[model samples]
Target: MANGIPLDGGRHAGTPTVGIVGLGLIGGSLARRLVARGIGVVAWNHRPHPYAEAERDGIRCAATLGELVDAGPDLIVLCNPLKAMPGVLVGLRPLLASRPRITLTDVGSVKGMVRQQVEAAGLGDRYVGAHPMAGNEHSGWQAADPALYDGALWALTVTPGTDYARFLAVARFVTEGVGNRIIALDDTTHDQAAALISHMPHVVATALVNTLVADPDRNIAAALAAGSWRDMTRVALTDPERTRAMVEEDSRNVAALLRAMAARLTGVADALDAYDDRALTAFFALGQPFREYKARERAAALAGAERQPEERTLAIPAEGWQETLLASARHGERLVCLAGDHTAVVTAAGMD
Candidate 1:
C-alpha cells in the first residue's frame, strides 16, 4: 500500500486516511509517517498546542475528539499510556454507535488489560492492541520522528473478536511504512514476553543505577565504571513513574520474573559468601557465551529489519503441487514441503 509498508500475502494496494488520538511521541511519529505516505492524518491532543504543532508538520489538527472521530479516517490510533486509556475509552465509548467505520488500535505497552477494557466497553471488533518496541528516555513531541519506528519490533496482540484481515492491514501499514518488524502475539503471550524482554530489563537497569547513585562511595564506583556499566544502566534514566506504573499494572508477571531473578542473585551471593570458587567460576563462565549469543541475535534482528519493501513476500506452494510454481514464484512466493509429520510447509522467497 502507500508509504512503502509491505503488505501481507493477498493484500491490496492503496493509501488510507488515519486519525490519531494523543499527539505524544508515538502518535506524532505515526502522523508524520502517515502524512509522508499521502495518507490523510487527522489528530487530536488534549493540549491545544500539539494540534498547532502538528499543523506545522503538515498534519491536520482536529479541534476536538469528536471532530477526529467524525472524520471517518480508515484507522484511529490511540497512543495514550495504559493507565490513561480507560478514561479515553470512557469518553470514546458513547460515540461508538455513532463512530465512523474505521479500524481502531492503541499503542499501549500492555495488552491484556487494554484489550479487556476495549471489549468491556463494547468496542470489540474495531479495536486492536499495538505495542511499538521503540521509545526514548526523553518523552514528548520534540522527540517525535517518523523514523522512530525504523528497525523496531512492533507487537500486535490478537485477541478474540479481533478482525484478522483488518488487523493484518494495520500491521502492514505500520511495519512497512516506518522500517519495522511486525510480530503477532496473543494478549497473554504478549504481556509475558514483554515482561521478560522489556519490563524486567528496565527494572534491572534502573536498580543498577539506583544502587550506584545511592552509594556513599559513588565517586569510586563512577570513576571505575566502563562502557559496560554505562550501557547496562542507560535505561535507568527512563521515567520512574511510567516504569512503576507498568510494573504495577502487570504486577503478577513482573513479580514472577523478578522473583526468579532474585533467586538467581541469591545463589550468586551465597556462592560468593561461601568462598565457593567452583560455583563462582561456573556462574562467571556462562557470561561470555550469553553475551556472544545476545550480540548475534541483536545483529540478526537488525539485519532482518534492513530488508526493503521490495523484499516483502508470503509463502505459496512450489512446483509439482498441482501445476507450475509460476503463479507463486511470479508473486515472489517460495515453497517447501513439510513431509515430516502431517503438515504442509511453504517458504516465502522474498522475505528473509
Candidate 2:
C-alpha cells in the first residue's frame, strides 16, 4: 500500500488507472497512449463529440465529474484550459470526499495559479501538479497522437502539503511509462522557467506575426520568407484561444520577460543607429555559446535515452573495492555493495 492507497495486484496493479477530465488535444493524446498501453482510461469531456470520439477509441467516457470519480481512478488528470481548472477542482470536491485515495494532477502550462487554486480547494495533499512540454499547433481530439509525449520533458511541481511518494509514483508513471523526462520543481520556479521558455516565446511569435501583417511591405516579406522567419513564427499557427488563455493566465511573468526582450531589442537598435560595428558584432555573437550549450544538452539527453538499465553482479577484488567499482562504472549506473561482491546496475546502450 502506497500512502494508505490500496496496492491490488492485478493486470492494472502497480500501474495507475487514469481518468482524464478533458478530451482536448493533450487529454485525448494521453488517453490514446494510456489505452494503447493496456491501461484502463475513464475520461470526461464537456463536449459530446470528443466524448463520443474517446468512446470510439476504446476509452470509457464518463457522463459527469461525479461519474468519473465513481469510476474509481487511481489518478485524475485535469486537462482543461488554464482558466477552467479551478472550477473543475471545486466541482470534484464532493466526489473526492468519499474517495480521498484518488491522486490528482493536471497538465496546465502555468502552474502557479493552478497551485493556488488546488491549495485553496484543500486538495494540495492529493494534487501533484504536472506540465508536459509537448503539443503541436493543432487542437482537439483529431490532433491526438500516442507519441505526443515521447522524449518530452514533463515538469512536476510539489507544494508544502504534497505527498512525495505519491508524486514519485505519478512521476514514474509519466517518465518511465510514457517515455518522458521528469523534472521536479516548485510551482513558482516552474512558472518562471515556463514563462521564459514557452510563454514569452509564444507571445513574441504572435507579436511578430501581428507586426509583420500590419506592415505595408508584408506581402513582399511573405513572398521572401525563408527558414529563419518560418522557424521563429511557427508557434503563431497555434490555436488563438489556447495561446490567449496561456498568456493571460501567466501575464505577469510573460510581461516581465517581454519587457526584458524589449530592453535587449532597444540595445540592439541603439547600436545599429550609432553604426557601432563592435557593439553590433558583440550583440549578435552573444547567442552563439548559449545555442551551442543547448545543442549539447539535447544531444546528451538523446544519448542517455538510448541506454537501457541492466543489473549485473560483479565479484570485487577486495573488501574496500566498493568505491573503486562504483567509480569505474559507466554513466547512469547504480552500484550496490553486496555481502562478498558488488552489484552494478548500468544502462547499457551500445557498450560491449
What TM-score goes with each of the models?
A: 0.78, 0.82
What residue pairs clash in candidate 2, if any at all?
none
**Residue 257 in model 2: lDDT:** 96
**lDDT of candidate 1 over 1-352, digit per residue (tens):** 3322233323332233677888788788878877776566788887877766778777888787778777666677898777778888888877667753567788888889888898888887887678888877777777788887765666777654555455645665564444455555677877898899888888999889889999999999999999999889877877799889878878888889999999989999999899999998988886786677667656665878575223333332332322222344334343332222222233343321
After superposition, the stretches of candidate 2 with alpha carbons farther than 4 Å from their true spots are 1-16, 297-352
Q: Backbone collision count in every prediction?
A: 2, 0
| Residue 203 of model 2, lDDT score | 90
Candidate that would win on lDDT: 2
Q: Deviation in angstroms for 279 in model 1?
A: 3.7
Worst 10 residues of 1 by lDDT: 335-344
Each model's C-alpha lDDT? 0.69, 0.74
**Residue range 225-341, candidate 2, lDDT tens digits:** 999999999999888788888988899999999999999999999999999899999998988867876676567678785743445555534343423332333232332222221
